[model samples]
Target: MKLSAIAAPHLFIPPEWDREINHIVIDSRDVKQGDLFIARVGRDNHGERFIETAIQAGASAVVALGEPGFRCGILGVPIFSTPDLLDHLSDWLHRAYAGVSQLDLTAVTGTNGKSSVTQYIAQLLTQMKIECGLLGTLGNGIWPNLAETRNTTADLSVVLRHLNDMAEQSIKYAALEVSSHGIDQRRIDGIHFKVAVLTNLTRDHLDYHGSMEAYFEAKRRLFVGGNIGAALINIDDGYGRRLAADKDITVPVFTYGHSDKAEVRYHNVELNARGMTATLTTPWGEADIVLPLIGEFNLANATAAIAVLAIQGFPFESLVAAASTLQSVAGRMEVYVKDNGPLAIVDFAHTPDALDNVLNALKPWNKAISLVFGCGGERDRTKRPIMAVIAQAHAAQVWLTDDNPRGENSDQIFSDVLAADGSDNFYCIHDRRKAIESALEKTDKDGIVVITGKGHEAYQEISGTRHAYSDAGVLIAQGYRKAGEDYVA
Candidate 1:
């Protein structure tokens, strides 16, 4: 596109330098030849400081967001000033990718279960011969054919491009995992969502959001403001209930849960070592589901996906049949068990509520449980000690291990997590691999070892570098079998 097309005024475009732009880049390091670098001011520093670096990196033009939100001027090297370029970035992105496909999208948002819910939707649809693309923490694509994404919700430009690619592949439906950060930053601003699903929200990401209200406000933006076609919520959650009843949500609201208030309620629920069996009563029809996934939270996640797909006009009987073949989401209640020893579960339960749910969900086994978990460094510090207390209360033994202790002292991280004046049940293991081994080695034949935080991740980061590591890999090396292969779990 031409410089005059975006800025309109001659003053906003440098004289004799209206060069053709190739790509719209925000980060200076990502700039390339003919790319238009956007200097957006952030919380720590302004992007104008990186303009020189961007230029050296072959950026064709630099358009910086005006300090007071709206202004226009000329700068060196085909540079220009625009009216809050960062704030209005989505507008330019929509224009740039105007021909991109707008698939029937369903954005699943919450602190936990975002990945599980989104993936379950994609998995179920794929099983029914529907081409559904996925965009979330797991990756982006159709089913198992996925590529890595930098974030759970990617940048607006990447999202548009990915959706367009999926559409080109003839995939008409999409499932998206929308995070609070993504919603707050307007990364998914131009998405035409068919339905917005809420699993539940709890204490997570308080560091960036500063408060629960602010965190919820970011999530609230996904459902309200006339952006989505319908709202599907889990009424069992306090926050979900608040959002369901919130006057700001102008769209039709559909509720799901075991609660009486839920429009799409599940009853006669049964849980066991194999999976969960439940009957779902929805506005469309009824479904008798038998999922191969463990955890009551998975029950909620599965139901949310089933309800949303039903709302999209899929047959209830086919969905009910598809439910029986549902596979466990990667790293989510993924089981690794010994021949006659303790059962080990690898999960991504970092938050207090998620940890609690995982522990509670494992209670049906009626075995002595050993837990190995740790909070990520430089994150919401308040949750660290809280997690310690929960671990001590739930498990017979607790191992506090390293979980991405980036640029933070390992000793300091453990001390914060082990905040108690007295810790009779805590064992500090700074090494992640050793922590998993120790936690498993000490457990009895009938016991269970639950590993939380950094699930499905292939590496462990300490200091600044990520070292290759996997909890499941460690267990398999120890002769523990995967869940489906004559497992003892």
Candidate 2:
């Protein structure tokens, strides 16, 4: 693209230096010949400090959020300075990617269930013959096929690139998982969303957000002022109730849950080893639905998915029938068992609320519950003790293990978890692999073992590095079976 096409007035491109820019890069290390480097200040450091590095790496032009500390004009390269570039970045991106296919986009935000809800929507849409893509924790792409991403929500530029690709591929629908950090950092600033779904708000990311109110406010932005076309929320959540009570929401609101006040309410809910069956009641219509996933939380997630499709004009009956085929998202209450072997579940339940839900959901099983869980390092520490308490309250045995002890003492993390004073019921095992193996060895054939945190995650971060690891892989290597595989013991 030409410099004149996407340039803001703050960016003064000299007539002599005017040239086409090949790529737009934020990180200095990624700059290359013909690339436009954007020097924006981040939470901890200013990108301007890396201008020299980008220049040396063959950056065509340097775009700074404001005046740099050093001289740039003397280098004979065009330097454009704009104050608060992040505020207008999305607009610039929209203009740069003009004619890109604009899909019907839905954004899901919450501490828990965001992954399941977004993935379910993408799967539902695709099964209905609509070309749809999903962007979230598991990865990004159309239904079953996806490429992994570093974050639940990628940088605004990365997201745009994916949207551009989706457009080129003729995909008409996209479901995005929007996280509190992503919203607070303005990573999704420019994307226009047709529907905003809030699964539920719980105590999480408090270390980054500083407070629950701040965390709530960050999530609140997506449903109110920005580019929301509709708001689909789980009114059962306390924060969701607050969001729904807001009379200021200009977009249409669709509420779902077991509450009678909910527009999409479900009753007669039943959960088992196979899946869940529920009697769903919605504004459009009602039906008994069966989803091949476990837990009341899954029921809520499915209800939220149903609400999303209903708003998109899909028939209630079709959605009901489609409910039977809704596949389980990776790591979210996933169950596996081998013949005569203990049933093992792997989940991404890192937060206290999520852990409680998953454990409670397993209450119906006849087998004794053995819990394997741990908190991530450098995260919200307050939840560690709470999780330990919840584990003791629910499980017959709790195995506490290291979960990505990045830069923090694994010993200290375990100490905090053990502080809950459930020493009688819990064991401290610093090695995650040993922890899983120990849990499996101890649980009887009639029991069930649950492993939480780091579900679908391929690596464990420790000492500022990611080491390869997989919860499911470890189990499989130990003679445990995959979902559809029969156990030969």
Candidate 3:
């Protein structure tokens, strides 16, 4: 597309320069021939510093937040200045694709389980034969046709572009994971969500939000933003309950939980090595649902999914039948049990609440439990000690290991975690592989071993480098092959 064509309504560019621009890119590293580079102000570094690099790499033109001198430095590319480059980029893209609308968006936000819930909703929609798109931690794009992305939540400009792309592709629905940071930064400004689901809030992103109240408020923005047609929330969570009580929500609110008072309630809950089954009673009707995923938390997750689907007009019988087919979300309460050995679970329970929930759910299966987990470096340190207390309180044996420790001393992170519990039953291993091996070696045959923190992640980042690592891969290497294989080690 010509520069003038794409920038017509959003920019007052000279008509002659329309043919000069061909492609648009935000990152200077990705600049190509005929590309228009957008110089954004980043958290740590100014993107303008790379203007010379981008132009030299064959950028045709440059759009910057502020003035980029008289020209585009050495490459002499045309420079366009805007006070708010991000907003301008979004506006330009939206104008370029005027036919696309942002109406049918659905955002899910919380500390944990957001990705799983988002994925579940996407899967459910796909099973219903709806043309849907998903944008979350796993990546973003049309369901079953995802494109890998580094950011869990895309920037405002990229989000608008993706929404436009989805609309162009005839996508009827979009499930989005609204990160607290993204919410606070207005990354989801223009999009209007039809349904907003709040899973739960916990201490996970203190490094960004700084306080629990601030974090909760960030999540509240999605529902209170007045764009959503309905809100699906887990009333069992204090934050979710508080959000449900909000007087400003003009849309319908559907609450789900184990509590009888919830609009969508579940009772006669049964969880086992096979999975979970519960009697669900909603305002619409009552039905039994058997979920393949384990954990009471997962029951709540399933309930939330059902509640959202029901609010969206899906029949109760369909939900009950479909609930059993819901597969295990990768790394979230994933169970592997063998005929002759211990049961093993791998999860992404890095937060205190998540750890407590996972450990509590596994308590019924085995009295002897071993947990292997670690706190990430440069993250919310407040949860480190809290997680220690929760793990030590729940697991019979605890193996503390390095999780990520990005740029921070591994020993320091472990020390803080150890100090949280003040328990001698826990052993520290700086090497993650050794920790898993040690846990496997020490646990009894009937014991259950849980490897937590990094669930679906294929790599462990440390000191600015990501090394190939996966808990499941490690377990598989040590004789734990299939879902029911015994690990004799």
Candidate 4:
């Protein structure tokens, strides 16, 4: 494709030269023969510094997102610049995927249920004999074949590239977890979503978003800005109701919740550590759905996924039947148990509400619960104390440790956590591994031990270093297998 043809429409200053290009590469190391290297403003340093390396790596041309009158020092290849490149990035980034993007995409946004809803949607689609690709905190790739990703939502360039790859691999459906940071950063601007889902909104990412309203506005972009075909809003949440009531959103909006007001309502719920069974009332017809997923919040997540599939024209009864077959998402109420061993769970419940939900959901287990949890350093300090209080409220014992301190003072993070709770049954063990081991050792064999904040995560980050670690790996290393791992040989 011609560079001019790819960029002219999106760029404020149209491309003057019509150089042929094969691919668009953001990283200099990824440049190959016939690839157009894009030097954009990165987090740390300007991408301009990598131009020479990209050129040497066989880049066909260079497009630099730089300041006005910015000069390209390298002379071997044609170089271009645009001061306002970020504004039009998604458009041109998507141009590379024009012929490849055939997947019907669903982008799910929320504070907590993004991963579960997206994963559930993918699982349900795959059960229907339809190939589905998923991109989120769990990883990025086709269902059950995902590779790990750094963020819940990938950068726009990576998003387009991954979508193109999924399309090439014959994946006709994709469900992506859209984070507030991703939306606020314009990482999802150009991808037109066939279905958009809201799981619910609560306190999270306040450090980055500054306020709840700003955080909400970031998520609000999904339904309002994108080429959204239909939106599934969880009217159960105040923010969801607010977003649904907004007059500016022009798309056909559908509501899903427990009440009759919801166009796709669900009721008659039975919950336990094993999973849930509920009757779903949808526009197509009513059907009972069962999911082997823990937490009452998962009911909402599953409902959102079911509503999305129903809106996409899948047979309602078939979807209801398939619901029971959907697998549990990693790190989201992920359970691990063996005969005579404790009922253990690993979940990514980093916020106050998430922790409360996970802990409270385990009440029907009919066993004493010991929780290992902590606040992430340098993130929404206000939630720290609240989480500590919530943890104590739900568990028989609370173990406090680090959750990705990331250069913040670990002592300070814990101090904030204990600011509210100055009582017994609260144990402070700074070492995460020790905290988990201690929590497990203290709980009886029949009791439940839950680890929160880092589910499915492979490493623990502290003071800028990430040590290789995993909550499930720690359990398995101690002779306990992953919740669903086969033991029959």
How many clashes does the backbone of model 1 have? 0
RMSD (Å) per prediction: 3.1, 2.5, 2.8, 2.9
Model 1 C-alpha lDDT per residue in residues 1-489, reported as the tens digit of each score = 865565453235545768677777777877888778888877688988998888888887777877433233234466566556765677776665654545788999999999898888888898898878899998988877889877899878778768777877777899999999989888899778889998998999998999999998899999889478899999999999999999988988999999977998888888888777888888877777787877788888888998889888898778778877778778888888777778899998999999999999887778899999998987888888888888988999989899888878888888887776455558888888899889888999789899999889888888888899998888988998787833434
Better of 1 and 2 by TM-score: 2
Write the number of the candidate with greater TM-score, choosing between 2 and 3: 2
Which candidate has the top score in TM-score? 2
Task: Return the TM-score for each candidate structure.
Answer: 0.91, 0.94, 0.92, 0.93
Model 4 ranges off by over 4 Å: 9-19, 29-33, 67-75, 423-425, 485-489
Which has the greatest lDDT?
Answer: 2
Q: Model 2 compared with the native: what TM-score?
A: 0.94
Q: Which ten residues in a row have the lowest lDDT in candidate 1?
A: 67-76
Across 390-473, the per-residue lDDT of candidate 3 in tens digits comes to 987888889989998999999889778877646566888889999988888888888989999998888999999999999998
Model 4: per-residue Cα lDDT at residue 246: 80
Which digits, one per residue and each the tens of the lDDT, describe model 4 over residues 268-358? 9898556878888888998888777776788888888888988888988888888888777878887777677777889999988788888
